[model samples]
Target: MSQPEHDAYAASPRTLEVEDLHVSVGDHLVAVSGVSFQLRRGEAVGLVGESGSGKTLTCRAVLGLLPETGEVDRGSIVLGESDDRVDLIAAGRTVWDRVRGSRIGAVFQDPGSYLNPGITVGRQLVEQLRVRGGLGRTEARERAVGLFTEVGLHDPAGVFQLYPHQLSGGMLQRVLIAIAISCEPELLIADEATTALDVVIQAEILELVARLRRDHELSLLLVTHDLAVVAETCDRILVMYGGEIVESGPTEQVLTDPRHPYTRALLAVATIGDWTRRTLDVIPGQPPSAGEEMPGCRFAPRCRYATQACVSAPVVTTEIGPGRSARCVRLDELDTEPGAVLVQDRIEATA
Candidate 1:
């Protein structure tokens, strides 16, 4: 009934809980605001939206890896096993260091940039295993080989001895996965992990991640702009806009029956079928820059259903369905079905 009650019901044995998160750069640039979400143990959550919507920033905040200028002005990142929640915003370096790799791991977009070119893959992975899990060199090497094999890498021994540049993109991604899960973290933050790969490779990587999750029983925070990817890999979705979560709910509920105008627009033009004659639909106008303060709803400028109330009213999340909410005043009046608009050419092609 109340927000607190809904949150209490939703916060069931959370592996990661981010409440009222506010991240800012320098003085006035608020990168993320009033962001809140939870990753249940062994569940996958998708933070989906366009670039600069604070998806990556939210993940970074969870991992205590914010940029030097960035600061958590408000909110708390509560993370741990059941009944062991720790507010990471108040935690010091010692706490962060302990939790960063062993308790929680990350797999960023590009393996090229994240992995070292000079170091052998096995060496880097061994170092992580040794440092994070405190294994002896011999034990760490054995663990590294097992991790490599677990992530679907062939010839684990041979691959481990090679540098990052020597491997293909898919192999490099597998290596990254091995490194991320080497310590068997409880939560894994994957920020656009499949963005750089081709379609076939992307699918393979997605499958690998899904299998790894099953094997490891890790909670996943998948941050990406691709709704399709989210649909395929995540169980829940959080749609962000202009650094705030505009809509959030079950993945199927949000995708097939989006309540927010932004979410609907995203679905309308998703190259669903027969794209040869279909011109992709695009959201009008541009998203506001990070920390760009707005008087009202940030998507008001591009929303076709926007009105004076939308532009003037104080924005807050209203529960639309079970465990689902949207940050809009006119949620009641908006159409429940996705009104994805396509180009005239697409309409004719369909006819």
Candidate 2:
């Protein structure tokens, strides 16, 4: 079948909408707060940030797979279009059972941990297809093999009988991808899915995902700390910091001309695209721990441009351009031009 046009899918309704989400680990400790974004049909959005930025927590909330102590303290996660919109927070286990794996699928960083070592990878996939897909045993097996082949696994039938430990890391990842998309879900969440792979394998896996998205019209939520991965795969980028989004815009615009100081700092450290070999820069200080109760801008302490006003009051997200917004108290005073925030000199001095 011919692949659908990108523009055709762009006009479709949103697949997921998260509004002012707040996730708390316990009575205190709000791990994720005031997070909001929308994923249009067939669109791929990357949520990028350093560790402890709540990227995984935000994705977990969307998937309704938060830890035992984690709970949605406030906010609504609406899934599906207007006609069939469902608030995931209000939806009980029964609703979740019906939604997860069928409408929404997820792939995590470690594929091995999710699969059973005792069972053949193919059998596990077949079981999922039989249970969630409602396929007969024979049909499920056939579908499993087909999915394996579709994901670029060589000798699908032969590989099906092998245990999880029998396959290489790249192959295991492909198996995980096959299982994730076996049900043909509308939304696919890949949380640092390629972090464990080498560069060549990572590129291959990313290409596979992009092709699948194009062919199946699947909306993707990619979570990762790697800016280069996001640059290559995502249409838009959401830069997270201290449990909140600090900057968001088109991928090209955000990469080339970040608005927030935090975003610029990240670019300084990231190795994106082809460039001459040079010492990489690093942001100073540690990111705030989850629910650390930052009264003002969370990034103010590490931001060189932060002023009294930045630390005196909470920062609000301000629109700087079309489809672009940033949360920074000194957005007007700072220079956000490409390569304007030169951290190389500081790095050299420290070195």
Candidate of highest lDDT: 2
Off by over 4 Å in 1: 1-11, 81-83, 272-278, 336-351
For model 1 the TM-score comes to 0.92
Backbone clash tally (model 2): 0
Query: All models: lDDT?
Result: 0.85, 0.88
lDDT of 2: 0.88
In candidate 1, what are the lDDT values of residues 29-131, reduced to their tens digit?
Answer: 9999999888888889999888888888888888899998888889988887556667877876789888888889898889879998889999999999998
Residue 59 of model 1, lDDT score? 88
What would you estimate as the lDDT of candidate 1?
0.85
Model 2 TM-score, all chains together:
0.92
What are the root-mean-square deviations of the candidates from the true structure over C-alphas? 3.8, 4.9
The segments of candidate 2 whose C-alpha lies over 4 angstroms from its true place after superposition are 1-11, 274-280, 337-351
Q: Candidate 1: minimum summed lDDT over ten consecutive residues — where?
A: 338-347
User: What are the per-model numbers of colliding residue pairs?
Assistant: 1, 0
Q: What are the TM-scores, per candidate, against the unseen true structure? A: 0.92, 0.92
lDDT of 2 by residue, 153-207 (tens): 9999999999999999999999999999999998999999999999899999999
